[model samples]
Target: MVLAMRHGAHLIWVGLLLCCMVDMGATMEFTGAEGQWARFPMWNACCESEMSFNMKTKSSHGLLVYFDDEGFCDFLELLIHNGKLSLRFSIFCAEPATVLTNTAVNDSQWHAVTIWRNFKNTTLMVDNEVKWVEVKSKRRDMTVFSHLFLGGIPPELRSVALRLTSAVVKDHVPFTGWITDIKVNNTESALLNSAGVINDLCGAAANMCLNGGVCNVINDEPTCDCSQTDYQGKDCSEGKISGFSFGPLSVLLTISNSSPLTKQQHDMIIYRFPSFQAVLVVQQFTENADILFL
Candidate 1:
């Protein structure tokens, strides 16, 4: 009886791993934007500083995630339509998308804002809660890697595009010690079975445009800013092979929240598309590849 139970445990673990496998993500990974943002508020102690979201292109797309002493999220819009971020998994957050005032953690301690994505939803987990439920969302689309905004928007949206600079010191407030860490992960996934896996990916890859162009990501072989209209879409993988590369074939793209692939991500990509031609395209990329890939 003991041996049978142990075997069963192993299968369950394997099953969990399998669910993550179906979530092979196509992302532009970035890292070490981790750690602390320098204690400089934008401009002055109390000023509306512009922190531009250097997107897939130089032009603005829309707002996604914002951090610093004050925080706001433009990505939580999906819950209205999808019902939940995921039916297979649950996430928790102490100081979540409540407000930029940093009350989500409740203890005033260091907290993490985990934005989780699955076939059905975009769940924000503060720390880790077991009984977590869906929260109101504003994200229009969900992708493997998304464009994020820090600081605040420039007056470009207004007339003060120049004032939308990064956080700087102001009055007596100093904008100091406002510890904030913003990171995203594909993290966990839920697969009902093989059939559900495929169904999920199609829906997962199936464009929400939920938050509108306000928030978007790099999945489905996405691409942006095509010259002369040769290519377009989230991953640049959508165009015809007609213009299939006789040129220099060099493109410079940025990847954010990146890391070495777990065995699962690697294998899933291969299983899904044998023609991936995987290579080490600079393991530590430093750009947000998903904002609005139109």
Candidate 2:
């Protein structure tokens, strides 16, 4: 009995190992090389079902995209639609039309795109920033897709079984970069898996720096060196904040006789900065307010 139990336990261990191997082998990568793409065909019964999806894309340039097919509703494409470098949700022939955000996305870095929809409402987020939102009282038609195409396809080719490509085109540009960490409906997809993969490509790439900042890696950590300039922060994102005297400038606030606030009356003071300089709003709340500037 003891020997039989031990044999069964060993079989279970072997099964677990095989599962791990399958998971680790699921991450697929494609270079932005010409004419390359990836497709995953799935057997989804109710393919038109609404889904909540989270996908991450790490690209240095160009647009990232994906396409899905839903039989009756036909097709849906998530891309930088209408030739703009912004995120768009396009459902072919849908009544409400395609939705898009004004935020430019060709920044050549890692960006996380999240889409959530329950037929009535749809929300999209990019790089932890909510890009677009729509709420409707009536439910919308969704795609009943059996396959997903990652990059390369004409928007009109819904029923066609065309292979994925890396070729560039007018309507849709093939994604030429790395994509990972994708989850649908809180469940990880086998085709979009990134288990046990060391994603050091960000560090390996030559021009990871932006805005002329120097890129360097120290002890496995990547850092951008930006020094002695008005542009502050690690990525040199902050604009120039100079031209003012260095030391701490003191100011005295005196209530204006023209617009004086009565006792026990609260006043709100708001300062709007000029357009040429940085946009800063200084608001003050007081029983008696005073405006002071040097």
Candidate 3:
């Protein structure tokens, strides 16, 4: 009985170590440099399909993911444009459908991104905020002949007229950030087929965060928390803003005072800012009633 108990405890320890290893190996950081990319097997987004991933970045513009039929028939692209996540896709050579999120994800924080497609309808979710659009194309299925490209595309496929069908896809900058646990159809995991991609944001010898910023290992990647630091930005190297940090309260007040929010708009903001933990007491005086935040 004693021997059996000891063996059981040993097995549990081994299982825990394996789980940690799997977690550490899951994240991949993109350098955002030219010719830096990862290629995964093509995602069959024809008809009903889904793709989801976690991403962290500070770049305002970069191509997060792209796949299509050698740029000929149909294509889909997820990118960061103007600090917001944008999803663009086309079916049967029709005008592409674009769904862009209002909440920005380029704040160097881990954000869950999901894309769901059903026939012509496509939905994009960033954290709890959601936006969707329907394609006007007559065809329902999207044909993709190329492998799914993440971070960027191969330099050889850069030509717009000859190679890629979508001209706009080539113009977006390459992604420079960390992406992990990419799932297609909610089952298949995307594995990187490229070299030079770092497994962790901060490797053994170097710390990416600067200016006394706290470096935390989240999802096996080094993340800089600039909240308590004098400096801000992705690596905590940027100059600090000259004001009190009121957290989400200040943002809510600014938006409430700027214009009247529709129910849909108010709901979206509420999803993004679910709590006002920083402020002691907060009130919003609108035409209808006063909403308190605490």
Query: Which candidate has the highest lDDT of all?
Result: 3
Scored by lDDT, model 1 comes in at: 0.27
Model 1 per-residue lDDT tens digits across residues 1-294: 999999999999999987674344321211112121111122210111112111121111112233222222212211111111111211121223322211233232433344444422333444453222333334322221112322222223224323322222111011111122222322222211110011223345544322111112223222232333333444343332223223243334322222344437531111122345653333332342322111
Model 2, 1-294: lDDT tens digits are 999999999999999997774454223344444444444444231322322332334443434545445333333446655432343333333443345665545554545566655453456666556644333323354454545555543334433334222122334545654565545654554442111122343336446555555443333355665554345566655443323433344333443322344677654544454455443334455665443443
Segments in model 2 whose C-alpha atoms lie over 4 Å from true places: 1-28, 41-63, 68-72, 81-92, 133-141, 153-170, 192-294
- The backbone clash count of each candidate, in order, is 50, 5, 1
- Candidate 3 lDDT tens digits, 1-294: 999999999999999997874485368788776666677888888888889888999999999988888857688899899999999988887888888899889899989889887878889999999999988898887787888888888767885456786777777778988988788987746454543355544455256777666554444445676666667777877654334335543432322222345766543234344554554667777685455455
RMSD of 2: 20.2
lDDT score at residue 172, model 1, on the 0-100 scale: 9
| lDDT ranking from best candidate downward | 3, 2, 1
Cα RMSDs, all models? 21.6, 20.2, 20.3
lDDT of each: 0.27, 0.45, 0.74
Per-residue lDDT, model 1, residue 63, is 24
The TM-score ranking, best first, is 3, 2, 1
- Model 3 lDDT at residue 2: 100
User: Where does candidate 2 have its weakest 10-residue lDDT segment?
Assistant: 192-201
User: Candidate 2 overall Cα lDDT vs. reference?
Assistant: 0.45
Q: What is the TM-score of each candidate against the true structure?
A: 0.22, 0.41, 0.60
Number of colliding residue pairs in model 2: 5
